[model samples]
Target: MARSQAQDVIRCQYCEDEPAVFHCVPCGDELCPRCKVFHLKSKVPSGHNIVRLSEKLHPTNQVKMCVVHSYKAYEACCEDCQVPVCIACIQEVHGKHTIGKLKDLYERQKAESEHELTKMKGQYKSEIIQRIKYFKNGEREIKTSHKNIREKMKKQAQDFIDHISAILTEALDESTRDEREKLMEISQYRAEAEIFEQNLEQLIEKFETLTESSHPADLILYRKQNPDTFKRFKFPFKINLTLPSYTIGHINKTQNEHQFGKFIRGHISHLTLWDDSLQAKYLTGFERVKPSTKKVSGRSLKISETKTQKGELYHVSCRDDRSAFVSGQGPGIQLIDRSGTELDKISTDWEPAGLAVMKDGSLIYSDYDNKIIYKVSLKKQKKIFINTDYGPTGLCCTKSGDILVCMHEILFSVVKYNSSGRKIQEFETDQNGRRLFHGPWSVCENINDDICLSDFSIFNRVVVLTKSGNFRFTYDGNVLKQKLKDRFNPRSLATDSLGHILIADNVNNAIHLISQDGDFLSYILTEDDGISLPHGISVDTNDNLWMVEENACVKVYQYLS
Candidate 1:
């Protein structure tokens, strides 16, 4: 690397060390770095140069007396050019032209020249900011387009596999398997290629910042002292890439090679047809017992009203162990604990539906009646997060701090939001796989970031979606019906620290705790204190269950051994 050069210093002409600017002595010669003296030089009539560094060097102030006229110093304006004259020559020179302060005129001209450098700095500062914004936005647009096309390719590949599978027969099973495997291999290769593309895009963005235009300063700025004004700007990037890499990908691959690529893949050999026997039982060890000496509530899971509201609670969410937030039935959202004690109110014109706590201690909620997403800071400042096309019903924050939102009456959609409330990406369709769960009522991100959505359309079951929104599997129908003791109308979903999925089965009036892999664990909540028709269920940061009873006010219960 080349060593950086330091800034050059500017100084006055008269004083070598003191920024001696202006002219030298009285001679009007350009001064050194800092001293304040004028050196004036004139061409004499005798063709000799007369220079005066100070007043003492003036020809009129010379020690020698004039040969013709003796006495005191003489002062007269020369008739022709107005040069200073002796008393003896004054009468001979007679009149004069214009007269001005030579030193004052020189000072004004120097000041104007110095200001030109300052004007250049102000112009560059603002210009640099606009250029930076354009570069970043361009990079973002390129990445988004790239991701969308990759998704399209994935869907095309899946369609190809499905077409091959549809003609499966006993005689062709082996061939079909081989064909499917071939497709899978192609997909794997393409997926890896997509990853490389993403990586290359990121590198390109980095390069654009590094190779930006250069800016050299006239003065060594005490940049440290003015950190805000002289903030460091990222340099323009540079990419040492070949042109072919930019055109990039299998869209350019040949048809014959593509057909041959769809053959038995190796990855399928590693996968086995999984069955219920593959599920491991949870070893809680304790013997099951009925009521009476029950550790939790022993009521017959009945629904009873503890407090009747003038209107229904639209959305109730856990704020903490002692408090929660609720929307609906009012103009705004309300904060109450498990005890139904209203601690605060968030005023709004529309009815709120769902709410969740963000990783940074902020509250995120959907105003279904208004079709807007709202965010409240820990300090209680509220702002609109997003305005959705449909009414949002479920809002959740994953362990990674991204927000997952479910909009009602819409084929299951999970839109992700960044910590700052910006929409990042959304999973809305199966262009990547199977169709999204219809009428997804609620959403939760499992320990593995596999998103789980509660679907109540035709099939009342929980649908597990891959991180990319691909349908991993369904958990319902006869198998789930036989394993469960009650109806599984999951209205809300939450994950415990142990990776168990806690689903609020509103129709059956119970909370079902299922194992991480979807094996039935046990009922965590039922009719306790005559609770029924649970509308909203949330587990606080402490994992304490806070539930909103439709027929009652609210309730909090701890699940203990």
Candidate 2:
């Protein structure tokens, strides 16, 4: 019976020659005593736990083996070295180190790993799913937005086509009416000529019959009855007709693109999550956050002056090249350099009532006499920009290249035109139906897109309105009455980068500065500063104030650093 039981025992998996005595937990190998010693001496990592085959525990409860002592199970862990150690290893190598039970360390690490996995599933995975849903919704919104835009585009195109069709119909109808009236007059004249021809033929037949009659008596009677009729007959005057002519307008591709609008693409970046709470713990060596600040001007300073020969400068517009376009009561607009040298000139039949320099270095001006706004290109090509019922006085170019024109006649109002010369908006009255201005002289746009104008009316106020034409506030120089000691007579208006409104007070001989909200700030330029009869003012990109005096002098000042 002993021999039979021994024969039934499991053989070693390594050598396959002797009955198994030990089992390596990590390797899951059954080995005899000799094979176990040989396996421990093999060139594998040292932490293979070997136990008696009969005493081997479940895989989950297996004892950890020390890396240095392959034959011994770990009894403790060296906290300082962060490794499991056997009792011999602790006594020999880690005797002075802080120690912890191997079982406790194993359980702690296992629990921490399980907790992290649970949190990942509960929070991180859910957050990722939410982000996916958000992207899906965004995609749907984009599709819907594109559909709406396409529909709008189609509708606008149809409207344009319809407008052109109406014009065509009107032109055809006018031409037909003119042709019908002219033909009727020609037909009436032809009928009168036919009658005259019939009468002349009847007279000639009567004369022939009398000559053939050989009766002198008959001829004499006829002559006596028609004595005055035989003298001479005059023909009707000739009718001259002129046909109507049509001139096709040239289409500008750039202006059409602006009118049609365009798509603005947004930038997309890779998504990243940052935990502020963990930043200090993980990014301790990183730089700390700092507050942002803006630089401000200390005081206003007179920079330079450019004398012009234009005579009574009415408007001044600064250019990016440090030059300026100055217009006056003279017959032309002059472009002058900072040193008062004439760079160029655009001659006009009459003085330009309003002047503005476009972003493309072109010039735009309003002709009060012609009731037209003209644009002069950089190539010196001049063309009509817009025709208005009222005379346009003061004009300015908005940041978006739109023109803000102030017109006054029976009604005082400001009109806004796009770069394509299409009228987009008009500001005439407030929400309460009250007239916003009696005479809007000079117009400008603030940095915040607010419309600021100097009203040369009985009120003598500076009107500030929102971009949508809503009433914001009005500054009538009441706050500065004590200092000015004169009636407010604002002529031209301008706005700086800081959104301060600079008004040329003609009566006070000063340029009053006010906040965008209509609060009086200060007199940035006055008689003491040599600002006399200031008519037009503008702010350049460098925050320099450019002013035009009635004496045709263009002065520049630095009010911001």
Candidate 3:
């Protein structure tokens, strides 16, 4: 285009005549409408950004300045360092690093940053907020519980004081009556002495009269009337006014005893609501599933078997590699090593059925014949821990050292007792007031402290109860689909460190593994695994499952792997 140039008029640089319409960024030239089109179409400055002259003073698409080099704008992004760099930084600090165009890099980085921020706000931050709310509610509940306990204790203290006061009043009334009786007795004796002195004076006067010949006949008659009285001088025995001793009673603070008029310390347990590994798996969106090993599997667990001379292994409890106790129709509970060698035999009063080991290396076993559970210490000292009306079938020592026993015959219930043999709680019926288990053969506590019972009756299932004795759920072998002919009779139960409940399915001759919350996981061992009619099951600290089979043998299976 041909145009005339005027310096004072601020005309288009290309036309050199008309006023500027737009500013060309790359060419740095003000152009009219025709010249702006020519500038956009020009091959030499093809990438120039054109802006309207009105918007030239305020550009919205201005590039950010480099923080390191204040005067320079970022031209490229270092892929290695993931940072934008100016021309000066590219050659100095980010030299030799793979570079990407600054615009493209900005778009990519913004998307990634936004993605992470959204996840933080939606999942992580939201979870934290929810946890905070839970903690707040728990705090309020704890405070209310403490207050209630305090009020109850106060009432009990007042009742105790009232009882003592009544006793004191009753004793004082009896003591006062004794003192009044003694005073009465003294007054009666004084009056009798006065009468006796008058009588003596009368007799003396009569004698003097007799001497004066006034009443010889009267004196003789008085002596004749007093003959019976002179036979015995009647006198009240010395009043022994001894009252029963009274002392002010006070509540004695005995050790480990329920103390009155005192506050018991309250505590809040630590909360571990969610697993971090599970959370990570959920966020990454990529599930790395393990190889399927469910049907017709091989040696997933290393198995070892041992047969005892007792010929019948009904129950087994493993504390450590050195101390795994087994019981049956044996003379005593046998403490066996991992190699199946009997380390010691604890003599029993009756045939042993259920066995459990305490945290202090002591053994607690149940005698089915006598309906007694005995606690045998490492020092050979034994004491009867509990005696149930029904036969005790299975028993387990909880993490808190409480013993949970499963009663078999009439009362099919799970009873919990402290280490000192005091019954803490009992779970007979479920939450809806229905019977929980039909002939609970075995019982175990999961990692979350929930009680699991193995039932062998018609409704063969594993019944679970919460730590507080509330029913949680029941597993009825529905999760593990087996043949109809093979019943779902669970003989014994055990739980690993991971909270997976392992039950010995007797009819199926397998070990059924279920999640802590009663979700069926998978079968650990099947009939193909050579486990025939598995009975008692126990898991050691190393997560090794020890099982007693009806074939008169004990099998050890390493399950943690």
Go through the candidates in order and give the C-alpha RMSD of each one to the true structure: 40.7, 16.6, 9.0
Better of 2 and 3 by TM-score: 3
lDDT of 3 at 81: 88
TM values, all candidates: 0.45, 0.52, 0.69
List the candidate 1 regions with Cα displacement exceeding 4 Å: 1-310, 409-412, 430-432, 477-487
Decoy 2 TM-score against native: 0.52
Better of 1 and 2 by TM-score: 2
Residues 1-561, model 1: lDDT tens digits: 233322244444445454323433223344542233233334432222223334434443333434445652333334355344445555554434443433344345457756744644654444445445634643554565567656756876787778757745543776667678877866776777777678667756644544453233412243434455324433333334332112324554578445433332111112222323323222111211122222333322322223535266545667666677766565677776544566777787666677888877688888777778888887889888888877787988887788888876535567887666666677767645656677787888776557888886777888886555656566662344554457567787877545567777777777777765677766766654355777777767665666776554666666632
Counting clashing residue pairs in each candidate, in order, gives 49, 0, 0
lDDT of 3: 0.73
Residue 378 in candidate 2 has what lDDT? Answer: 93
Write down the lDDT of every candidate, Cα atoms only.
Answer: 0.60, 0.80, 0.73
lDDT of 2: 0.80
Which has the better lDDT: candidate 2, or candidate 3?
2
What does candidate 1 score on TM? 0.45
Q: Is candidate 1 or candidate 3 better by TM-score?
A: 3
Query: TM-score of model 3 relative to the true fold?
Result: 0.69
